[model samples]
Target chain A: QQPVQSPQAVILREGEDAVINCSSSKALYSVHWYRQKHGEAPVFLMILLKGGEQKGHDKISASFNEKKQQSSLYLTASQLSYSGTYFCGTEIRAAGNKLTFGGGTRVLVKP
Target chain B: SAVISQKPSRDICQRGTSLTIQCQVDSQVTMMFWYRQQPGQSLTLIATANQGSEATYESGFVIDKFPISRPNLTFSTLTVSNMSPEDSSIYLCSVGTGPTTGELFFGEGSRLTVL
Candidate 1:
């Protein structure tokens, strides 16, 4: 099943913060985050395994709650380069390596 | 980490024609995957290209419509056959180390616009 992403769209001023959430109805083995600008392919960001680990890159970080079957991506002190569509791809343990991506959340950052 | 590239970044084609998109990886990979992203939509897996054998397509996709060729570990091609406006999408090829993390690296993608 496809994952659900919250806050369809968001706009923030530079140096602000925002959070995008992804939830799945089924248990997820891992959750992967990716960002894509207009006219480009999605870029890999980070992955959260089943152990409920939190991963960070630069000012971007994410937390996965195994029991809740959800994950949250935190963008702190957002920069202009942070503007893009963010997608959460879920991997189920029984489904091999295939990923089912969420609808995505469009984020815009104003200077 | 793998460096991937796709040909024909964007193309406009007539209906009923076919377009073949090529994907090349800098290093050999055990698996390569093809995905379709329709306008304003999330990525959808089309198939898993296995070298030296038939491709494993997803539920809604078939080999006749989206033929895939994985001649080697580092290269593959996805051909959109009998194209129509509905077939227009961004086709991406991805490769990963393995199924453990489910982490994949994607190409720039080949954009197709059928009219």
Candidate 2:
């Protein structure tokens, strides 16, 4: 099943903070985060592994709780560039390239 | 990371016709996948294009309706056969960057508007 993302939409002003959450019913080996701007392809942001291994840009902060099968993406000091849709892709197996993306969270960072 | 190019950024097709979307990656990748995003909706996995083999489709998707071809590691095609209004969506091509981490690089996507 696809993962569920909370707060379908959020509007943030410059320097504000916001958090997006994702929950899955099945066991997840990893959770991948992506940001897609208007009229553009989704860009990879970060990935959190089941064993606590994380990879991606340093500025992107995220957490994965395996026991609860949930992941949270924290956007601190939001900037205008952060205005976009965020999606969380969950992987169920090790080395499983296939991912089921979440419903996507729309974030609008205002000036 | 890989650079992906998808053909026919947007197209208008009539019902009962078919549209084939091409995806070309600058670098050869181990895994490639296709996804569909409907109007104001989330993305749904269509299938996984396997090199030198038939594509693996997800549940609620079939090969006959959506034929896929992975001629090589760098190129793949997805054909929407017998199109309908419901088939209209943004089809995205993505190449996996990590096997364990599951990082995927996506193409610009082909937007289809079926009337």
Clashes found in each candidate (C-alpha, N, C closer than 3 A): 0, 0
lDDT of 1 by residue, B1-115 (tens): 8899999799999999999999999999876899999988899999999999999998999999999999999999999999999998999998986755656889999989999
Candidate 2, clashing residue pairs?
Answer: none
* Candidate 1 segments whose C-alpha is farther than 4 A from its true place: A94-96
DockQ computed for model 1 against the true two-chain complex using alpha carbons:
0.64
DockQ for each numbered candidate: 0.64, 0.73
**Candidate 2 runs further than 4 Å off:** A51-58
List clashing residue pairs in candidate 1: none
Chain B TM-scores of the candidates: 0.96, 0.97
Over the stretch B20-107, how does candidate 2's per-residue lDDT look in tens digits? 9999999888889999998777789999999999999999999999999999989999999999999999999989865545568999
* Candidate 2 residue-wise lDDT, A1-111, digit = tens: 899999899999999999999999998988989999888999989888865454436455888888889999988888899999999998888756688889999999999
